[model samples]
Structures are given as structure tokens and as C-alpha cells.
Target: MLIKHLIGAAVALALGANTVMAAGFASLGEGLTPLGGEKSGNQAGTIPAWNGGITQPPAGYQGSGKPHVDPFAADKPLFTITKANLDQYRAHLTPGQIALFDTYPATYQMPVYVTRRSGSAPQWVYDNTRKNALSAKLADGGNGFTEAYGGIPFPMPKTGVEAVWNHIARYRGEYVVRRASEVAVQRNGSFSPITSQQEAMFKFYDPKGAYADLNNVLFYYLSFIKSPARLAGSAVLVHETLDQVQEPRQAWAYNAGQRRVRRAPSLAYDTPIPAADGLRTADDTDMFNGSPDRYEWKLVGKREIYIPYNNYRVSSPDVTYKQLLQAGHLNPAYTRHELHRVWVVEGTLKSSARHVYSRRTLYLDEDSWQAAVVDQYDGRGELWRVSLAYLKNYYELPTTWSALDVFHDLQARRYHVQNLVNEEGGTIDFSQAPPEDSEFKPAALRRRGLR
Candidate 1:
């Protein structure tokens, strides 16, 4: 079986040769045609972006087909990063970055296959649905099916995982079956259920098993584009789950001007992130508070996915967009139209990558692409930290991604929680608005009490 899978993978590699080379430097803007902006085409008169083979219409008009198309349309990604290209791309990464990808291929290299669905909602919507389904599955016990190397139990129940996997598989199957059916119907003007054989062809193959060598290729590709920058004034709170009551645990980003990590403001139920300089402090209490200074961050990617908010799905009809966005729970502009493919990253302390728990692994959902789940280990390589993000859905947004996220730290028995829902009477619009620069600043930490 493995041999057959390998042979099939080799064929795929051969077929994807051009795509692999194209992807190797796609970040360099080679062979792509730009669109929807002032500069739409390249010097050779070809579009600067990949338009999925759709031709643009006259000025001020949208494409007759679909306005929103898959960015990776036309060509499929070939061989993901493996030992073969590790050295080739290693020069472009930091040592910590290198170790992050090298740690796990099974969880990271899971191939995200795209099925072209016509009359489908925008790519962002599909992206959200996929993520939401995955989250729902995890919450229900999908995490239990597979265990990590160190006997770390999966988080969810078998039933939940099966249900969620079925949902995801069905969605993917429908897209694939529908596309094939559409093509056939287009030619013959008739319709029928997809054949079992056809379905088998798509379902039987495992991208992870076949392409194990190419794990983490997507991260490398994303790094080539725009990497995540640290939010200068952003304040983040890591909620620790002790025996019982959730307290106003604190940590703050250091505002260099004030030269301190002061005690951040205690967040109300839900508050809009204030402007960057609304509060500034030079005291450790104001910044980091009393928390240990043993963590780091990196922006992977952004996409729309569901989160837990207000005890139910915020994106559902019962809730209003006005309430969610005002309280800093939802940002329609950044998440609404985004089909984010997130980064699979790791975080470790400054002391050493070889701490008692050598490393920590994080899987960040692309849409509302926050770090949703974290897997940590102890110095003896035993699984120690299991953090889960309970997300709330933000309805008014185009995607069903989360607006509020609560992190559960299993080992430390604490919780790190961050909620972006709007505060009452906050003057932010739910419509398309860019994220404020201050929202990510260190000073904002002191004001929000999220440090």
C-alpha cells in the first residue's frame, strides 16, 4: 500500500513540476497577472495575478462568471517542503523558524485540496465553513482520534471527530462531485449522482500519507509573501485556568516610550480595542504585570473561522453585527472577505529551544487566524501543555469565523483569553474598515488590561 502511494505521489510530483517551480518563486511575482487595482497586468501584457482562467470584462464591470475566484486556481501546489528542499529554503529562515516546521509533518503538512465550486459562495465563505466545521469537530472530540508522540490524548470525543470529519469530507466530496457533475452536465445537459468509483478515486488517497515529505511547504510559501509584524501597542491576555474561578490575570506589551510593561486595564465583558496610545505605562506592572516573560509570537496567515462568543454563535442571526464588531469581537474588514490559509508555527522561551519541554506547537486557523490550539511538552519530552481555544461565531461578517476566543491551558491549569467583540457604544463601524494601527500596539495593552 505504501509503495502504491509512493508511486502515485511520484506521478503527482511529475505532473506538478511546473507548479512547484512556479510556487518556488510565486512570491517574487513571476508569471502572475495583477487585477482589481491600478496595475492589472505585467510588462508582457499578461495579467499579474492568477485569475483561474477567467477573462476580465469591460471597465467597471465584474466578471460574468464569479467575481471571487480561488487564488490558487488553474495550478495545484506541487511537492511541499521536505528534506530535499529544506536546505534550499533554510537560508531564508531563522533557526527558531526552521525548528518549528521540522518538528511535525503529520499535523502541519495536511494538504488543503481545493475543489472548484461554481455558484458557490465566495472563497472566504467556503474557507470559513471548512474551518468552522473543523472547530466544531474538535470541540466535539475530533482531536481524540490521533495521539501525539508523547501519549497526549486527543481533545475531542470520537463521535464529534467522526461527525466533523464526515461534515468536512461531505463538503469536499460535494464540491468535487458537483464539479465533475457540472462539467458532465455542461457537455450533455443532464445530471446524476457521482459514481462510487469516481468518489473512491477522490476519497481513497491521503495527501498526508502520500506527500509526507512536503509538510510545511505552505508555511515556507507564506513566509515569502508578507510575514506577520508585531503589533506595537497590542495587549494580549493569557488566561490561566486554576482550580476554579477565572481571575483578572495580567500581562502587558512593553511600550518602549514609557520604558515599562505596566499593569494593563482589566477588560470589561467585551470592549473595543482602544487606540494605541490611549494608555501608556513604563512599569512592569502596567505591561507584563506579574506574568512570566516566557513566550513569543509570529503571524502565520489570516482566514475566516468560527469562534465561541456570547455563549452562542455570534455570526448567527440572533446576534447583531453592530453588537459584535463594536465590542471588538469581530472585524469585518480583515476577516469578511478573507480565505486565510494560516501558518503552522511553534513557540518557545528565550532561554533555550531545549527547555524541559523542548517545544510548543500551535495550529492557527486561517480565518480569524488566531492561535486556536497549542500543544506543549515538558523537559523530559512529555506532553505538558494542551491549550484549546473556544471560539464564538461572528454573524454579520461574511465568514462564520470567531469573534471571541478563550484559551484553556491544560498543564499550567490556567487560561489565556482574548475577546475582540465591540464594547457597548463603541464608535467602530461593522462595515468595511481597516484594523486600527493602535489595536496591535503595546500601549493598547495597558489601556485594555490584556497585557
Candidate 2:
């Protein structure tokens, strides 16, 4: 792994990106706010500065396991951005956002509201991030890092890859289990659901595990498909690594029909996702996930973009599949967008890397390090797909993650959205207890597979 120790204005100038907080641990929580969000509010008062996020769920919320109530249910959109008025907001909108209008001018619209910087983590997380600032350095070719555990790895990121790393290493929670569905919708708004029970244990956030104990693994994931006769009982296991360059991700798949568990090295990169119909790629799963080994990422400076944020209405239990899903996009009235600051990073596929996306433009939320929108290009340099993530606070953990992640294929007029359980109750569990290492092994995959 290639890691450099250059932290200064020179690196920023060379990389063609704006440098944020000063180098070192002392700057955090002082001049630099926790989680790397700007401490001061924007001049226009449209975007407020970071305050402690929703530590306690909204007043009516039934605690950690219940459906989260919309804290901003009474709040209204400041204005709506459509194709007619898009030009005025063009500078602030990502190319993906603008393309949606061109594709569905009449139906696709963004209900933009005031930006709320509500990203927060536990106090221990903040403390760990401050310590990580002093030690975390890039790994070989910038695909991995060392000397950092828990917290944001590089708060004052200098390179484009560093910014990407920050997004990859961002905290979701210590451990979480979710029951959700991934649906692929066709042009006529007809859809088929792929429901699954998934568990993720972020070893990076394991308070008991120290830096040395991480063993290059960031998280362990298991997805067990629960429905559809043809796909039922299919399961996937992944041991996502901290340094994928040194050791590739360890993946295993259990075939319900075959009754066999086998190693699946093809889980990463641009491979069509196993459960997804053909609309999305493996790396496109988390808006943008997996290895950075195939692309040359560049920091393009920060910009204000109208992105999905604090979207409780989208996650409200009142919505149903019939009401939420539409031909070209989700029901606009049920979605919410906010004008917020985001770090723009572009990835150009390497000549040697064999992948579908020739180029990708990623917009990472400044406060949460989550991808708000990603523009994907085909080999011919034509815009092919756009990915959007509706972010909401998992209030008890006080972390922001995708409530629903949608990947729209512009050419096909189709899209795939994961985690659409609005009509269902209590889909996420933050047990604060990490999974045992035994559960992620191949033997366990076989044991858990239905015979």
C-alpha cells in the first residue's frame, strides 16, 4: 500500500481541490467540527451549521426499534425545482439531477427544502475520530489505510482518493440488522421484489476492537434472500476489507437449489449484482461501494447540490408500493430534497480496469460522508445511469445512512431501489453488539443454508 505524509496547502493546490481544516488532531472540535462538517453556518441562513443530530428520536418516536416519526413533518419545501425552473438552480444541481428532468420533464421534480446538517454519532465516535486524525494515513495506491480505527479516517482529506476514503470509512453504526427489499421497476411501473434479511457489523466501529485487531477487515455482511420462489434461500456472505489491495474481499455464496456453498470472487467491481435485475452494478450498491483500485479519483472541490436529506416522509409507514413507485421515478410528493454542501469527486476508469462505468462523478455529503448522488457513464462517454440515496437519521445511533437507494438507468427507463420498507414496521436493529467472527465463515454459510 502506498501512503504519503504530505499534509498542507501545496498538496491541495497540486490536487486542484480546496483544503479544509488544518492538519493534526488539535484542529478538530476547535476550528474543525466533529465529523468534519463546517462549524459556521452559510451566509444566507439557508444551510444551518452542524448541531448535535437527532440523538433522541422525535417526540412521538417509540424508541430504537420502532418506525421513526418525521421530525420535519410540518416543515414545507422552500421551492420546487422542475425542468421549467431548473436553469435557475442548474449550478447547484448535479448532472444526474438535471438529467432526470430531461428524461421525465413533467413527472420528475425535486422538492427542495432548507438544508439541515443533522449528522451525528456517539461521543465515543467523536473522540475516536479526533484520535484517528493524528494517525490515519493512506494505504497503497489509496485503496486502503492504516493507523485508523473507528471514526472518520482522514478528516482534512487532501487528495481525491483521500476524500473517497473518508466516504468509504464513514461510520454508519457499530452493528445493524435490516429487513428490506430491493425492487427493479420497469417502464410501466410494474416491479418485482427481492426481499432479504441483511446484517452488517462495522468492525471499524467496534469499541472493543483496537486498531491492531481489525485485521484489514472493515465490515462483515450477510444477506439472506427471503422471497420469490426462484430466488428464495439464496444467501451471500462478504468479509469487506479495510485494505482490499493487500487482500481481496472474501465472498461466499450459498445456492438454495444446488445446496452448495462456494467462494464467489466476482462480488466486487462492475459485476451485475447477484440479487439486482440488471439495472445496477456491485460498486453502485451503496451509491458507490468497493475498491478504488480501478479508477483514478480526483477532488473537484465542494459544491451546493439539491440532495435527498432528512427524508422521514419517504420512510413513513403510511406509504405503500402502489403509492410510492411510479413509471419514471418515485412519487415526487412523497420525496424531499434539500440544498446542502457536498464534496464533489470524479473517478475516471483506469485503462487496465475492466468495468462498465467509464467514468463516475460522486457527490459525498459534507457532514455524513455518504453519497447523495452519483453520475455513471458508459464506455462511449455517454451518461448511462444516475444513482440517488435518500438519507435519514437512524436516530438512536444518531447516524445518517440510506433509507432508500435508487439506481436509475436513463437508457432503459428502469430503476432499482433497495431498502423500500415504508409500509413495514421497524426494519433496522442497532444492537450495539458486534457479530461473532464465526458467523461470517464459509462453514457458517453452509450451516445457515437451507438443505
Candidate 3:
């Protein structure tokens, strides 16, 4: 018995050592490193990198019009990449472009928590937190309160004509309930039940209010992408995990010159297609960020680390930006927490022969597989564009990821931004996406006056 006990102790110690080593060197591949400049930290302050939790209350925390505090204030970033010394890190890039990392550290830093194996359902995490003091105020007592008080029991997808019914059901079910809760809270100075439709409508359309809160849950669902089969004639929704209704919906790329939207073709995994002008066509499509056809995608890899989102941190992103930078541009954000786990991906024109940017680099959140930041290059190998997408959780939908906002930068001083929301009594159904080729044509763009 004594001998056995000694052996067990020895094994336990060995295992603990191994785990520590593994965590320290959890690289996605040969080139990628943690968001920090060094793999490990020293006595000096944590290496400067992007810090997401630092922003003030109104800027960082959202929901119930309440403010939340940052938990990792001590772990703030120590450094960031700049115009200087960008060349020294070129060999590490898979897409070969330098992007603005510090400008949006939450988007660039890989998340490590995503890689942590959690036996608990993602919904339970939020649910349990809500039952606690901090999050309890936001909890609507689960499905019962949501249905009896909030309005709709379930969220409907945002899409087409059939969506009209979905909107009505949601309005009657969830929206009504939410408004009641809000009015009761105001009138009695405590949580009250919604009693009227007009009150609900007021809450539904009020720009300063929340019609529906569904960001995290939606992202949780979207994180389930796992080698889904490619669709017929439908562009492969590659890059981030495909978990949302808006994720796989077909899209038409708008051709401004022709004043039309063309149905984009789906390309096989890693299969390159040549463009008519010897350039490559952007091959991926989906609904986030304007529409599909706005960008192309290439599979990178899976790995682990910390990332910036709301108040918590996670690990993801396996690829690095070493290969995708111009000769001398630097990444502005380079904090420690942002160097968590991630899946590095590449997006470019199908054929390498012709493209405004020969290559683009994307850092996808490993847990959610959502594209956080993208760096694009010009034909002359100059850094041209940088894009960022923010993910928010959805409580009602449960297990899905949705974009809160999207931003883009360009050499020609052109830029774009967008925000998404689920409006109360609003008619938007994403579940039943239009038939594959139905709305993705030149005539469709003209009819909608988008072109």
C-alpha cells in the first residue's frame, strides 16, 4: 500500500508538470505565437498588447443599461506593434499582410478560454451566472419569464416573406413580455409584468432600448461548426464556425459597374479558380458584414489562447500575421491577453494572379470561429485594408454568434461600418434562407436598388 501511494504521487506530479508545459507552449503551428511578444511573461509588466476590458462602462459593457466592471485589470497589455520593425516578423505570416491589431485588440487577440474543454452546456454558463448576484438582474427567470413577460418564446430568423408570420409570433410572445417587464420595473420601481401592447411597442421601437437581447447565445450556437458537408452550388461558408442562421445563407456580390448582384459560386476546399482578368474571384459568401461576396476565405488552423469579448476571455486563433504584411508596416495592438488561442485563416482572390490585395489575413476566434480581424494588401504589396467584426451573445436563441458591428479601412480613404440587432415585433427570419439561386442575381440587385 505504501509503495502504491508513492507511485501515484509521483505520477500526479509528472502529469501536473506536463500540463503546465503544454499550456506554456500551446502553439497552433510553427510560426504563430501568443499575443505577447514573448511566449512567457517575466517580472517586468505584462508585455504591451491589446486590452479589451479597459474601456469605460458605457463603452465596454452593454445590456439593461447597467455598467459592469473589468476583472482582469491587473493583466493589462504591455506592448503593441507599430510602423517600426515590422520587417523582422514577416516570415511568420501565412497571408503576408500587416493589419491594425492594437486598434481592435479584442478582434486580433486569440481566445484561450474557447479551447478549454467544458463539460457544461454553453447556455448553462450564462444561466448560472444570471442566477448569481452580478447577472441575476438581467435574468428573465428563463423561458417562463421570457414567455409570460418578455413576449416571444423563441427568436425567428431574419429573412424573406414567410418571416412576417415569425415576426408576429415573436411580437405576441417575447416582445410583449419584455415590454411588460420594463414598464413594471419603472412603475412600481421593481420587476413588473408587461400589461399592454402599446407599452411593448414603445420598448420595441425605442432606439435607446433593447428589443431583444440575443448576442452570446447566438454565438454559442455558431461555435458548433464541425466539418459540415459543402452545399450544392452554394458557396462554402468557410473561415469562422458556421452556427448562425445568417451564417450559411447564400449571397450575391454586388457589381457596382453592372448595377447588379451576381450569384457567387462556391469553391471547393483549397480549390483555386482563375478570374477572367487573370485575377481570382472572392469565393466565400454569407450574410454577416453587409452580405456575402464581399470577402473570400481560406482555411488556416486551430489552436488556443486568450481573446477580448464583453468581460470574459477565451483562447483561439492558430495562424499568425507574419506572412501577410507589407515590407514595413507594424501591428498597433500587441497585448498579452490578446495572444490567446486562435485559428489563423487567409482570404484572397481565388487565383493568385490578379487581386487588389494579393493576400488577406484573418484571425478567427477558436471557440466561436468568428472572424475577428482581417488585413488586406494592395497589388504593390502595400498594406491596404483592415477589417474588424465584433461578436455579441444572444440569450433567447441560445448557442449562436452574431456580429454587433463591423468596420473596414482602406488606402483610398474608403471605410464601412454596420450594426445588427433583433427588433421587437420586427419582421426578420434568418432560418428559412431564400432558395440558393433565387435572390442572388443581377436582376435582384436592380430590383432592390442596391446597385
Candidate 4:
């Protein structure tokens, strides 16, 4: 019998609570979803049970290397929530959502669709998750984790940091290559798209590898600008470490104008993303990423909220950017919101730490551990930014990920959206052979740039 106090003994001692629990394969697939969510639906029966979520592609899907076809295309919105109806749905909406209604009373709204439990992973991933449930443990004061690989590390997390770790280490396939664009939409809705080709090798989820083989590196990422002649040929490479406190993330950038490659140490934490126009920080990349050492995480329990889910329309090749991007946010006509149970985790900056966001509340989907919505606060403890991840299951890979990520600056009245591939010939490709480790080296980055 293996038992561990999730969030670590130090946190439990400080919080003065005994949260120790036993973990094994017995609870998985029995009392909990394969990935650790509640197996049953909500009391209202709006959200359905996890009946082995979309393990196969829809009938109309053309297969890999194509845009995913919406399985719920025939479903209609149950209702819409605008500024006028906001009060009625206030209990189901996040504070950031309410602020959006107040910020753009006329345009910003939520088109609530039927909830679909379409989050899933392969059978092997489920098996690995069960293994991780028994082995994974927090390391170096919640900065990272150890003794887990190939699946979610903390399937049945007992603390906020453990839940956050699950989000950071969720299964994202072994290798993938995607071509997408990012745009920082201004107040008037005018913007220039910054397109790029990105690739990632999830070493932590490598099917052929084990925990002992990780060597602290979780994944390798490389991105090169593809369009807007001025930024073309520029590239960035990153070696994301699992234990960041022990070894910070190693990053390198290739500047096309300078024709030189240099180490990029400013790619972590609160550093403002170059093309983001200061709307998002570097750690805000995948909803939330990097180290968790700067903040105190608290598990605020669960809530049934309307979060963006199964949003195939927003990622459709048929929807043009001009028609999708509105002045305040993405056109509500294409966004799909559904009511589902989510785990709410809050991160508050430690009094001694320094960062732009003083506090952040993250709502993660119970089934997938994906951050669906995040409300960020400034130093004055005022709402400053809101981030949403439009989630959809890539049925072919049998995994759910964000089709588009939108970061809104409530104060500036502008937003930035990324991972737009509506016009791209192909989307994410997980079938590609994994690239050599050398490809992520600084020398390779310089070589790829010169080409």
C-alpha cells in the first residue's frame, strides 16, 4: 500500500490539516474517471458521465492532417447570456466572465451549448495515469514533481499545487508539429497576424521512456516565424525542465536581423511576450506554465461553471479571422460555452515574490485538467486580465487541447489570440516522427534560421 500526502508534508503542517491518502488502480476507472475526475455526472444531470470519451474520430472526419469536424454540429444553444441576462447566470459564471459582460455590454456574451464530456486519452495513458497516482510526489517545495511519466502525475490530487502539477504534466502526445498564427487585437479590432511553425517533443509522455530516463527535462520546444517578412527566419528553442528550481528552463533565441543566436534567459516567469503587446506574460503561455515557486496555491474546491468547451467552430477552417475576431472578443456566434464541473485553484503571489499578476484564479476541467478560464488580478487587487482556452478533442489523437487561446486585457480593452490556423493548410500533426534532440540545440536553431 502506497500512501503520500499530496502538496507535501510542509504544506499540510503549515495549513494544519491531515490530507494523507492512499492511491492505487482500485479507485481509477471505478470511483473516478480514468484520469481522476468523478465518474458520475452532476446532481442536475446536465453534465453526463464519462463513458470513455471520444476514443475515435467522428464519421465525417477525413482522418489526420485535416481540421476536426464538429461532432455536435447539429446541437443548438440552450440559451444565451448577455448583459441583461447576466444576473440570472451569475452563480454559474466566473467573476471575470461577469466583468466581461460589464466591459462590453453590447457585444460580449456567452452562447451556452449542451455539455459534452469529450475529453479522453488512449488506454495506455490511462494505465500510466494509474501508475503515476501511486508514484508521483512533489519535489523541491512544489516547484516540480518526481517519480512520474507518460500520464497525469497527480490523478487524484489532494491540494492545489498537486492539481496545478496535473495541468502542467498532462498527456499531450509524444511529438507534434503545428502551424499557427497569433494576433494582438487592438481596441478597434485591427491587428497583424504573426504566424509561426511550432514543434514540441513531450519527453515526459514518451511511450518508450520511463521516469528514470527523464533526467529533469520534461519537453523540448522549437518555433520559427513563418510569415510577415520582417519576423521571418526568427526562431526560439526551449528545454523545459521538470524541476525548475534545481535547474531553470534552458532557452535560446535566434534573431534574424542580427543573424546571431543567443541564450534566452528571459523566457520564463513575468517576462512580457515580445509579440503579445504586453497583454500576456511568458508563464501564461499554456494557460499557465513554468515554476510555481513564486505563489501559494490553494484548492478552492469545485464549481459548476460555463466554460468554453468542444469549440470546433472557433477553430474551423471555414471561419475567417475577419469574421471571428470582434472588437471585444471572439465572436460569440462561434464560441461554445458549456456547464461542467471544474476544479478551481487560486495562485496568490507570496509577499516576498515579484510578478506582474498579484493573484490568479484558474478553473480546470475536471476530466482533462486543462485550464479552461483564468482571471488575473493586478497589484491593486483589481481584475486586470482574463484568459480562455477554447477546448476541443482532436478525435484522431483522442486528446483534448485548446484550439485557440485568448488573453484579454480588461483595463486596456484589448485582447491577444494565439493558435489561429484557419487559413493554414494543415493543423497539428502528432503522427510525425520525433525529431532528434540535436534539432533543439542552439547550433541547430542558428542553422534553421539561416536556411
CA deviation > 4 Å runs, candidate 3: 1-298, 302-308, 311-337, 352-358, 379-382, 391-406, 420-451
Per-residue error (Å), model 4, residue 229? 0.4
Judged by whole-model lDDT over C-alpha atoms, candidate 1 comes out at 0.25
Which regions of candidate 1 fall more than 4 Å away from where they truly are? Answer: 1-19, 23-357, 366-369, 390-401, 411-416, 420-451
Instruction: Tell me the tens digit of each residue's lDDT in model 2 across 1-451.
Output: 0000000001211122234433434556765577776767778888786767666777887766578888888888899998899889999888888899999998999998877777777888888877776667777868888888888877767678878888888888877877777678889999877677778888888888888998888888887777766777778888888777788877877888888888775566776764456788777878877779899999898898889998877767788887888998999999989888888999999998889999999999888889999999999999999999999888788888888988899999888888877755666888646658898788988778664
Give the TM-score comparing model 1 with the true structure, all chains together. 0.27
Two-way TM-score contest, 1 vs 4, winner: 4
**TM-scores of the models, in the order given:** 0.27, 0.93, 0.33, 0.94
CA lDDT scores, all candidates in order: 0.25, 0.79, 0.27, 0.85
lDDT for model 4 = 0.85
lDDT of 4 by residue, 122-165 (tens): 99999988777767778898898877789888887778999999
Residue 293 in model 4: shift from native, Å? Answer: 0.4
Give the alpha carbon lDDT tens digit for every residue of 107-158 in model 3.
Answer: 3332212111110113332222122211111121111111111222111111
TM-score, cand. 3 vs. native: 0.33
Sort all candidates by TM-score, best to worst: 4, 2, 3, 1
Rate residue 265 of model 4 by lDDT.
55
Q: Where in model 4 is the C-alpha error above 4 Å? A: 1-25
For candidate 3, give the lDDT: 0.27
How big is the positional error of residue 45 in model 2, measured in Å on the Cα after superposition? 2.2
